[model samples]
Target: MSTIERKTVVLTGASGGIGMATAKALTERGFEVIAVVRDPSRVRDVGAVFQADLANLADVVRVGRELAEKVPRIDVLINNAGLHAFSQRTTVDGLPVMVAVNHVAPFLLTHALLPKLRASRGRIVHVASDAHRRVTTLSLPDDLVRTAQFSARESSFLYAQSKLLGVLFTKALARRLNGTGVVANSCCPGLNVTGLGRESRTFAALAKVLAAVGAFSPASGARIVVRLAADPESGSTSGTHFSRDGSVKVDTTLVANVALQEQLWAETARLPAVSSLGDFR
Candidate 1:
C-alpha cells in the first residue's frame, strides 16, 4: 500500500481533534495527506506537516505560496483550523484573532492555491459551524476589520459571525467557479468538544468531563468533511451547506443570499492580504 495514488487533501488544523481524525481517515481511504499546522511537532503520523500560524496573516500567506509551489496537485483544501478565544485578542494585522484564523487565513490560502486546484478541478471544504444561526445580520465592511474589544460573554457572537462569513465565502466561491470543475461548500461539525476556546484551564477540565460522557467526538465531526472531500458524488455538489448530521440541509438564511455573498467576496478581496495575492472578482 506504499504510495497508493489517490487525490491529495490539504487540511488545516490537522493536529486538532477533527483534523487528526480527518487526516487518518483520508489516509486510510488512499488520499495523500499534507497537514498545515501552527506547530509541526504537535502533529505526527499525518503525512507531511507545513507549519503556519493561521492567526498571523503574513505567515498564512507565505505558507499558501509555499504549498502551491510544493504540492504538485491539491484535490481538496479543508479549512478546518479555528479557535474560540474566551477573551478578545487581535493579530498583528489588526483583525480579531478568531476571524483571522477561522476565515481570513483560509480565504487567502484557498485563493493562493486556486491554480493547482483549478487545474485538478478540485473541491474546497470549509469547516463552518451551525452557530452561524445565532447571528441575525452581518455587515461586511465593518465586520471584516472591526477592532473593538469584547468580553468573553460577547465572544460567542463574534465566533458565530465568522462562521457565517465562511458560509458566504463558500457560496460565493462556488459561483465564481461556476463553469470550472472546482467546487466549494461549508459544514457544521456540531458541538465538537475538541476545540472549546483556547487558553483556558477551566475549559480543559470541561473537555475531559465531556470526553468521559462520550459526546460529539472529533472523529464523529470529521465524517462529513471526509465525505465532502473524498466522495465522488459530493464533488458534483457545490455551494450547498450541510448540517452536523450530514444528512439534513442547513438553513441558508444568510448563506443563500447571493447579494450578501457577492458583497463578502468583494470585501474579502479588498483586504490587504487577499489583494496582495491577486485581484479576485
Candidate 2:
C-alpha cells in the first residue's frame, strides 16, 4: 500500500469572498487550509486560522513569524487579502492603508515564510486584477507606499495602482525564485461580489445587483486561484498574470520593463515596515 501526502496551503483573507471559497474548494480536494485573518473566530470551522490585522504591518510580521515557526511545510501561499478604500487611510505602519493591506503585507508574509515554501517547493498565487492597466501611469517607488491624496471619486484608480503593484511584485518574485523550485503568479478574480466594498453602502448595493446579474460568484472567481495553487501544470509556470479565463495578460510595457520591476522590488524591501525582512535566502 502507498501513502499519500497531504498538501498544505496558507491563505490570507479567508473570511470572505474568493479567499473563503478557495479555502473550501482546496479543503474539498483534501488540502489543509491555513487562514491568516483578523479574527480567528470568524473562520474557526473552515480551517486553521491565525489572527492578524493586515492593516498593521507589524502585526503581519508577527503573524508571519508565528506561521513560519509552526507550519512544518507550506505547499502553496495564496495572497488573497485585498482592500479598496473609498478614502485615503493610513495604517499603524504609517503607509497607505490600501498599499499596506493589498501589497506590502503580502510581501512581508511571503518573505517571512519563504524558508518553509522553499522546503516544500511551493507555489505562490496573488489575487490581482486587470485593473492594473487602469492606473494610466505608475510612478513607482513613491506610489508603491504613498497613496495619492484623493477623494472618493478617484478611489478606484488608486485601487487599480495597488493591484498593478501586485503584478509587478509577482514578476520580480518569479525571477528571484528561479532555481528554488518556487513559482509565482498573479490572477484576476473578475468582478466578484466580495465584501471588499462594505465601507460604502451604495457601492455594496451596486455590487449585489451586478453580482445577481452576471458578476462571477466568489466560488467562480476562486477557481483560477485554486488551479494555480494545486495544479501540477502550474508548477512550472511563473511570473505570469492570469485573467479570469486563465489567459496570460499584463501590459507589455510593464512585463518588459525589468528595470521598473527591479526598482520596485528593491524599494519594497527597504520599506520601513518590511526593511527588516532580511534576505529570506
lDDT of each: 0.86, 0.86
- What is the Cα-based TM-score of model 1? 0.94
- Which candidate has the top score in TM-score? 1
Q: Give candidate 1 regions above 4 Å deviation.
A: 1-4, 276-278
For model 2, the stretches where C-alpha displacement exceeds 4 angstroms are 1-4, 210-215, 276-281
Q: Over the stretch 1-281, how does candidate 1's per-residue lDDT look in tens digits? A: 45645688899999978999899999989888999998898887766889899988878888999999999889899999988887778888878887788788888898888999999999999999888888888987889988788877788899899888998888888988889999998988887678655457777878888889997789999999999999888988988888878865646577668899889889888887667656765
- Candidate with the greatest lDDT versus the true structure: 2
Report the C-alpha displacement of residue 79, candidate 2, in angstroms.
Answer: 0.4
In candidate 1 the C-alpha lDDT for residue 215 amounts to 78
